[model samples]
Target: MAGDRVRERRTVETMIGMYCRGNHGTSAGLCAECAELRDYAFSRIETCPRRDGRVRCTGCGVHCYNPVMRGRIIAVMRYSGPRMVLHPIMAARHFLP
Candidate 1:
């Protein structure tokens, strides 16, 4: 369970980091908006009823996020997805962590 939480946290952190870097041109840390999203995501993950890291949010097909947050995360993923290739280690770590 602790391992799952770490994995979930790592994955969300990586995604948000990528999104913030790609969109805001900052490699330092998350912006205010992305930070909020990160916090929200972590809260959702920590309280997740499923508790299975193997089944990701998309694969689980569970609409856990609120409508607004869902849309925001989707947009972030869409914007940051293609750019993720450049960060191979981070991308791979997200899956392997």
Candidate 2:
């Protein structure tokens, strides 16, 4: 179970990172994507940090590139397996209009 949890965490971190990067387009490091999502998710909540090496978007409840928060976010998101597979659509629904 612990191994599965670790794997699940990695998977969620990757997926959240990808979503922030906007469907795997040509982007640089997670920082760029983190910045973009920070701007996008800020409206829903204040103080979305892109500089602290971690950014959490309350709108979608996904943590972007923040090692500290990644595991927790993944644990929650993992419950929604289909949603993880359909992350782009799901993220859009939550973070977008």
Candidate 3:
């Protein structure tokens, strides 16, 4: 479970990094907005009610994020999800059951 959370966090960070780099034109690290979103995502993961970290957020019954953040993350996911092929290992680990 703990390992799962770490991977989940890494996946989120990777997606956000890709989004920030491509959209925000950050060459090195996350931009401020993406950084805040990353932190919020990490906090949400740490405090997730499903401590085992078994379920994908999309499949979960809980909608933990507020509307604005939810929309932002949905955008990030949409953009990065297809491009995840650029990061094959993370994509495989993320999608593998």
Candidate 4:
């Protein structure tokens, strides 16, 4: 499970990297959406009940790296059971290359 989570994180990170490169590579390490997500995630971390201080996907047990930034992600996956499973599709729409 941990391995899978790591893989998912890496995949999302890679996608964010590609999105940033395609749009605004010279500005910062992350794009606007990714940054927003990061900020959102950070803001919610203290309040969230997850052990690692992250919002996890109920369906997959995948932790959200930027939970606070994307409300839609949380909303869509709120029914995924124990895991939080923010939609990769949504993240892709806003941040994927």
Best by lDDT: 3
Error of 3 at 13 (Å): 0.1
Per-structure clash totals for the candidates: 0, 0, 0, 12
Better of 1 and 4 by TM-score: 1
Q: Specify the poorest-scoring 10-residue window by lDDT in model 3.
A: 51-60
lDDT of each: 0.77, 0.43, 0.88, 0.44
In model 2, where do residues sit more than 4 Å from their true spots? Answer: 23-26, 32-97
TM-score of each: 0.80, 0.30, 0.92, 0.36
RMSD of each: 2.2, 12.5, 1.2, 9.9
Stronger candidate by TM-score (1 vs 3): 3
> How well does candidate 2 score on lDDT at residue 5?
32
Badly placed stretches (over 4 Å) of model 4 are 31-33, 38-97
10 residues in a row with least lDDT, candidate 2: 50-59
Candidates 2 and 3 compared by lDDT, better number:
3
TM-score of 4: 0.36
> Where in model 3 is the C-alpha error above 4 Å?
none
Instruction: Please provide, for model 3 over 1-97, each residue's C-alpha lDDT reduced to its tens digit, 9 standing for 90 to 100.
Output: 8888898889999999999999999998899999999999899888889766679665577889889999999999999998987787997897787
- How far does residue 30 in candidate 3 sit from its true spot (Å)? 0.3
- lDDT string for model 1 (1-97, tens) is 7787877677677778887887888879899988999899888887787886667664567789999988878987787667656678756765564
